[model samples]
Target chain A: MSEKTDIGRELDGALQKPKRQLAMVFDLNKCLGCHTCSISCKRQWTRDEGMDNMWWAVVNTQPGKGTPKNWEDMGGGWDEKGEPRPSKIPTRDEFGDAWKFNKEEVFHGGKGKVTYLKPVNTKGESPDWGPNWDEDEGGGEYPNSHFFYLPRICNHCTHPACLEACPRGAIYKRDQDGIVLINDKQCKGFRFCMEACPYKRIYYNHVQDVTQKCIFCFPRVEKGVAPSCARQCPGRLRFVGYLDDEDGPIHKLVHQWKVALPLHEEYGTQPNVYYVPPMSPPAVDSLGKVDPSKPRIPTAYLESLFGPRVKEVLAVLEAEKEKKAKGEASELMDTLIVYKWPEDIFPDFVQDPAEL
Target chain B: MLVKRIDVNGDVLGDPAASVWSTANGETVPLMPTPAAMQPTKYISTKWQNEVYGQTKSVSVKALRNADEIAFRLEWQDPTKNEQRIENTDFPDAVAMQFPLSEDASLFMGGEGTPVNLWYWRADHPARARSDVAHGIGTSRVMDDVSISAQAVHANGRWSVVMRRALSVTKEAASAIQIVPGQTVRTTFAVWEGGNLERAGIKAFSPAWLELEIEA
Candidate 1:
């Protein structure tokens, strides 16, 4: 273990190849609450059997049911003692189905009064829902309801919860570049990783009778190429680099600038992917009673995702906001390199093959 | 040559080069390695390679088990796009696959014609695939993995077709077809549509694509 195995060496050589890890960092503000990411990921990964039900990457419209519906509330990843947490498999309706036209109605009845339109199940069965059915769709009244997209995938963690949960040691974290992968040959399909994962990114391939997850594209990374999804993104929101690269954006965001924060940091998985939490609009007076002009990014919402430490971070952010408002630059985001559109900041991925 | 002599020593089938008519005489023809090679690749944990002979230009070889499948990564390229084929008047175009049976030897070549389904698999013997022919898809086929894709060839000329199979000797097979830029090479394969060594253990016979590797 001390000398790094062949795979470890392979991963080591891959890190400096300049092809990069190819990670997507969605800007919550610009997400538009669209299910484009979910649909794209599904087409690329789950177009085959067993993977029919899988959405390796999903976009959740927050303040609403997340994919695998209620994944956040499941409390997997790791317990206080670091044991794995079990998870519930999502139903077909949960992920949603591909939209279909009522061809039967259209074919037989010309100009039918009521056209039957529904999502078609790949298997010919009428699945109730699909991967993106509920995206941007919430159940609430006007004014109070709110939503934002939370695109998710395997964190490929520094201390992966799923990696530790596999009893057969079928799962491994490559020491060279730290990509957590399941050796399909050794995987028992026990799905311990599925349960151990806090983000519920691992999918049990029923057809293969084994467990599979995001690979971080080892072949491409080793060959100095990026993953398909990251490379093909139409929105340049993806950043491909190493966490250890001090000059890399990931390093600066997670450690140095400390702007990007992990979701539910209390889970203690030390996830590598971090989110720079989006700021929300101020609350409204639903009752027309209590004043609703309070600053958005509600303390409750922030605390729930980032823990109580969010309070201190928000205070600094607000003070900086005040100073900047009065003509003085805020120290909060000053040292931080904020990328912009057509560039890195709020960058859109160029996943559109047609465009290329 | 040791290559022709070796085939004569085994239960030699009909013309080995009949299906190879399109191949150049100088093209490096890959022969089956030692029987022990049925063992999986050390670098690639989920792959198995071997070579076999047969007749005709097309046939179907089926694995005798319920859990094995396959994909052929042919390493080839054509400057003039001459002999390289994209479709055969009757097949879908894409990667090809076959199911493998328990205790059967790994395959050296399986044509890209079977349809792929959720419960699809090859039922041929893993330890003795070469000794006998494989099985054919019956009407009773439940899990569908038998998919033939030679129809998707949009290119007009000789295109490099890697018969990538979703072969399942184990629980799940790694769908590793994403080419890694300059590190990966476009390979070639020879396809035979007919063969008949199918003796006692043999079950079926069909078109097969034998993978060929080239060194610079």
Candidate 2:
């Protein structure tokens, strides 16, 4: 990792530039919709009271209403001139609730024959949405229906709208690693951060009366281990390392190969987390004839998310896949394949968490 | 407004409904929205543009002091009793009393080297008021030792709250405002209507400080 690099510059001069920036790149093509990252993040950080409904690392199905329901339409982040765009705070019902189950009635209430287990929210109403309420429910007509898993965490943006929105100066990016954090001691729970975050990643802790989000597992990162979400990912789709580490996959995939792109770059926060856009099979016509020109997963939708570079990135990926198919050497293909376990993905953070 | 000196104990002064409160003259303090230009961040300033916040027109206040304690009865009309911070959009109704540490402290929360001490109470935390010291906008810090005690009752489409504290708190004395007998102090007030989603610098506040003369 290179030192003295001015990474994650402030929204204005309100914050000092960081020496280094830790980032993650998710290979969206490899994600299995298994939610290992979400479960790992929950078990590690968000099991407390008032955090029952918060899923810091959520695997959202593309082309579906996200965790907060229509978060895309909610305005936030900076506009073209770096002016803050207005947005409302997402409510509990919008993000869905921590549903309670009738496990007791089904198993031990002696009504097992008739009583069935069902989930109900704190208000005792059936939840209309959840973090994965639209799981596997892809969009499009019969044969062409398609979707991909989009696992999201706090983007840890360089120009963090959340950090800029905090009136109390409670949210800041670390000068060392560029990890954005909320100073719970200083936070008055104004929640302007939630309003300003285009990604809608921050959560309000009602019990503690403060705002909380993904910390990037700083404690584990400082101990030379990757974040729990990355380390525990069963699909090994998450790559973690310093952005300036040219040998690292994060730098190669994002800066060198230029395949990984930030989601919703128009939000203008410069998110640290990037995604290698997913590839899909060709669409089928009404007569069941394969249409090579049209991808099942619409390119327009991906462009709306990762911006117009989706076409270029997809072309490069397809070319590399063809090279590998013909038994030719392809550096990009090898990096994406993860042939060497942790070393291939996160070379700098290969420490086994079990040993720690 | 004079804070009348009474022979009653702290308990009598701490109750908002006490008959002794009737003896003290009530002052109707007019309030206005905190200037959007003075808001701390661009996001807050932008969000406040279309929102109807700080709509509360005025508040009624009565001040009294016993031998060792000072108390104030504040009454404001708010039809909704928003006490819970359970939902993301739920902001509890709150009120604050501000006093300057130095005469130079600006009414806009104070400036550098001129801090203001704030006695803040929220509907959710009704039993105690947080003692905060701030230096300019968005700088309010909750003191290590909370010195103010609060009692509040919501009824008849209005809220009656009593905030009580020692005349002089020796602990964290630097941040705590000292209320001495026979002296006048400059103080201001702010109120937040949770239903309006008003918080931080988006609330109604007294444009100028009110001078309170304490009876010797």
Candidate 3:
């Protein structure tokens, strides 16, 4: 098997194969950058004393530095030979410290007119970056400036770098559904997971002195309910199901339709979470004429993130979209459209959370 | 090194500046970097491959014992004081004394079935030390019920710390080393420089065990 596709094969018996892997597919085209997923995840798990800076579910604008501020430049995950890649532990400032606002002086102190609210960081300085520091700031010149929202969560990879990085065996992939988690009781606050995760999704909880990330809403998943992020997303772009379930949308999109691709597959972690590449309109010329040569969003930049297969996936998406526009039958377009709520996107986890 | 029998009060024995420590013979234990080959994970070894860490060359040790307890004063030089654990990247400076449960146990940590007791002191928690037991590297488990008293002061680019405990402990006896007077035992030392981001197997340690004799 190619080293790029294999998972846990090079771990030397350290990782165990899960019976079934739970996966999610995010359609970047439909994302509206509303941030409901981020808020839902925060309200569900990370609203604690030390989790002020953690965004377990983040929606970053493309061509931007991302949450940790140029995290792509930081090294992590595995090398081409399947050797572990070393990474730096991102600092509070790099991840953008939770801003402290002067609510007291503005609202309750009876000085609202004079003292307007301002955000101060931990060191009592103005914050330079945040989770969405460069929102809507896409690359390229005027008539063609374009960007898309890339909503991210823990990949819950097949061979998790965080699990292998931990010396105390504190991180594990669940045997039942392959949901990666940190066993806080066994964690010694070493933060090695933060250093090994290529995605840089893990956050350190200073109060608890432990590393934390997206748990994939395992409790809700176990009870036949989709993850909070997917359930709360207004775009209905997130698909959650068992990867091996042939009839499921996740399998169809990932294995059959092959439209969904793993982000940064070269990281060598074999992330279960996949994404359908976003399509952009063609760029316009300086003469105000429609230019069909290239898209406003550079294909090279998209290829850098989604890998070489992005062009092929985008071609398939374009063809299927054209067929749908011509009023012809297209399973791919029908699946992407999601005619029925909850049932079409997540058949296995279609149970409403409110009913539970 | 002899743990001298002193007539000092328990309060004074735990103080790093206490004059009672002057009576005991102090030894400068030489330290070396923990071998990179022994790092528990590949990521850690790779992270340290091009970096300089575990640079602390030596530490001063002095032991003193009273009627009921024993105390050891450790003094080491460090340019920076890192005592905060509030940030993800902040690792507090720490020191640990290791004692083997079996004579044949390894100095690096004990082997399987051969446990080692560790008296661990971190700069963040200044008032107390932790009692931990481990069968091998990366297996250290805290003995929460057992408390080891510690007092530390960082001044003039050097840290003076005193760690003390009962001469004999009954609770968690299997994990805790009972330092009996008039008996010879072996001990080793490891120091973590938080400024260098050293922790776990990435610290400086005495290569060999130092023999200790407590005066009866």
Best by DockQ: 2
For each candidate, what's the DockQ?
A: 0.02, 0.88, 0.77
RMSD of each: 16.9, 2.1, 1.6
The true-versus-predicted C-alpha distance at residue A32 of model 1, in Å, is 2.4
Query: For residues A1-356, what per-residue lDDT tens digits would candidate 3 score against the true structure?
Result: 34234334435655457878899999999999999999999999989988988899999999889978888989899999888888899988888889999999999999988879999987789988887889999678888888999999999999899998898889999989989999998888899999999999999998888889999999999999999999988999999988888898998999899999999999989999999999999989988888887877889999999999988999999999999999999999899989998899999888888887
Residue A296's lDDT in candidate 3: 77
**Per-residue alpha-carbon lDDT of candidate 2 for residues A87-146, written as tens digits (9 for 90 to 100):** 989988888788999999999999899979899986788888776788888798978999
Better of 1 and 3 by DockQ: 3
Order of candidates by lDDT, top first? 2, 3, 1
lDDT of 1 by residue, B69-178 (tens): 22221222211222211111111111123323322323332213322221211211111111111222111122222332211111332223322222222322221222
lDDT of all the models against the reference?
0.43, 0.91, 0.90
lDDT of 3 by residue, B138-175 (tens): 88888876779999999999999999898999887999
Compose the digit string of candidate 2's lDDT tens values, residues B1-216. Answer: 999999898989999999999999779999999878779998998889777889888999999998989999999999999998888999999999999999899999998999999999999999999999999999999995857899999999899999999998888777889999989988999999998888999999999889999888
Clashing pairs in 3: none
Best by lDDT: 2
> For candidate 3, what is the recovered fraction of reference interface contacts?
0.78
Specify the poorest-scoring 10-residue window by lDDT in model 2 chain A.
Answer: A1-10
